[model samples]
Target: MRADPNLYDYWPYRDRPKIVWPGGKKLAFWIAPNIEFYEFDPPKNPSRPGWPKPSPDVVGYSQRDWGNRVGHWRLMELMDRFGLRGSISLSTALIDHHPEIIEACVARDWEFFSHGIYNTRYSYGMDEAQERAIIEDSIRSIQTATGQRIRGYLAPALTHTERTFDLLAEYDFWYTCDLFQDDQPQPLKTKGGRLVSMPYSLEVNDVITYGALAMDPWRYADVLKRHFDQLLEEGERSGTVMCIPLHAYLVSQPHRIRAFEDALAHIAGHAADVWFATAAEIAQVYREQYWDQTVADIEARGLASGGTGFGPAED
Candidate 1:
């Protein structure tokens, strides 16, 4: 389905300059580690009580087990190895079942972005009140568990509505990754003014590489490296921002976690020229510097189109 025309308009080749990093850094990278759990509840039409039987192509029983144990540990190891903290997009239900994970995340100072109450159950068909309750409950649960108010949100399966922004604003979230309007953080004009849209990359995400392509971790690493290299080259001409979405279950597996490590090492090795920051940090910077009234002046004058395409911005 096409995006709502009234919500945004896209015009490529606008005159907005590339977003420069703090202190003239070449590229800014944001890593998002998502922890998800898919519970099973079959529809009444089905002759089953659980989710529709899983296919080999989709997540199966084997993958679920792998994601919970090996996958979770590997992600932790990668964070330790790279000396990087990430936003953990978590299922509220999973957090309830695994409170230790929440504690661990807090100890590591990781940012937590709600992925929803669970993956399989979505918020799409719910009424306004139901959706609002789901969002508020997820925030309250996370805050109670981690002692940190959730500042960002990622819709389950990226399924949401126009009201999503209003709800997020009501909850006082700093940003949401639901929209892919721009690479650098951009202002989202909501009823309450603006909130930052921190774009998440579907192209570089582990789900596409592993779940879709069925490729090995090595291949995933190669794809990541190629993207990073191209963006670094572009950074010379214009600033670039890259967001890499990772699933705790997919990237945390023993074989795949290695690729995650390799990718992080590749980026960290060049830390001098790259700025690695959380989504919150990115949004804060964009609000203070790029999306302020001065920058809005340029947008208003048609110097730059307010919305770019839904692709991640290259470095």
Candidate 2:
């Protein structure tokens, strides 16, 4: 077994390479709203349990159902108020189930990226063919629904296969949000095509803030501002990416939406220095400006490609 995934090289955070974003911006701030669909009683997988509770877990299922039915509207309105266009991490089935939500996002000219066919479907234990079919369906459905081809992916519920990266590249995807290894864009080692790792954070993600940490809404707001503050400071030296991943089910509760707004307003206040972009846009610019330089630097450092690929260093 490989010690490291060799997905990317061990590029040190200190003074490696400088990246100045377009229009002399220091930070590319993006928002990923995970608008997903969950099944009440999904088929079971032995390796990974789809839910912690039993079949027809109404509590779990209905909470997510509320997201689609009522909560997402509040989230969307709040985002619109702050002029933040969502980069939706979509469950492709939502296009068929709730076309209205897709229509609303389309009207705003927001972005739609794959989050597989359903949140209930996990990539674990899926053969190569099954995984490929998932990817193919996501691309075709989202394209046909929105008239925009999906260029980025965040694997459903973050279940990724061994061949995930390779298949994504083979399918001409520009980026994947599954890797959380860095604050800046990194070139992933794909067999043939260029694929970038976009920063899609879990720390400040609403689900984490509310469920894992049991944080108060006000503290959640503070966490977001603090997260951005440090990134903005570091970004002065070279460009950095700051992503806030959200789940409407958690953040759109009446008590919490205002707090979420407070955090966004804090960021939006710094309008001059931040470039609010989507995952596809960030991937496009990074590939154009820095992908080659990064690949060469990693290879030169013997961290990836040909040499001892990611192991104990020798003097």
Which candidate number has the best lDDT? Answer: 2
TM-score of 1: 0.85
Q: Which stretches of candidate 1 lie over 4 Å from their true place?
A: 1-5, 11-14, 42-62, 236-238, 293-298, 303-315
Q: Which residue pairs in candidate 1 collide?
A: 71-252, 240-315
- The all-Cα superposition gives candidate 1 an RMSD in Å to the true structure of 5.1
TM-score of each: 0.85, 0.95
Counting only residues 3 or more apart in sequence or on different chains, how many pairs clash (N, Cα, C under 3 Å) in candidate 2?
A: 0
lDDT of 2 by residue, 232-268 (tens): 9998998999999999889998888888888999999
* 9-83 per-residue lDDT for model 1 (tens digits): 343424556667887887778889888776654233222223446433255645765676667767776777788
**Judged by TM-score, which candidate is best?**
2
Superposed model 2: Cα runs more than 4 Å off: 305-315
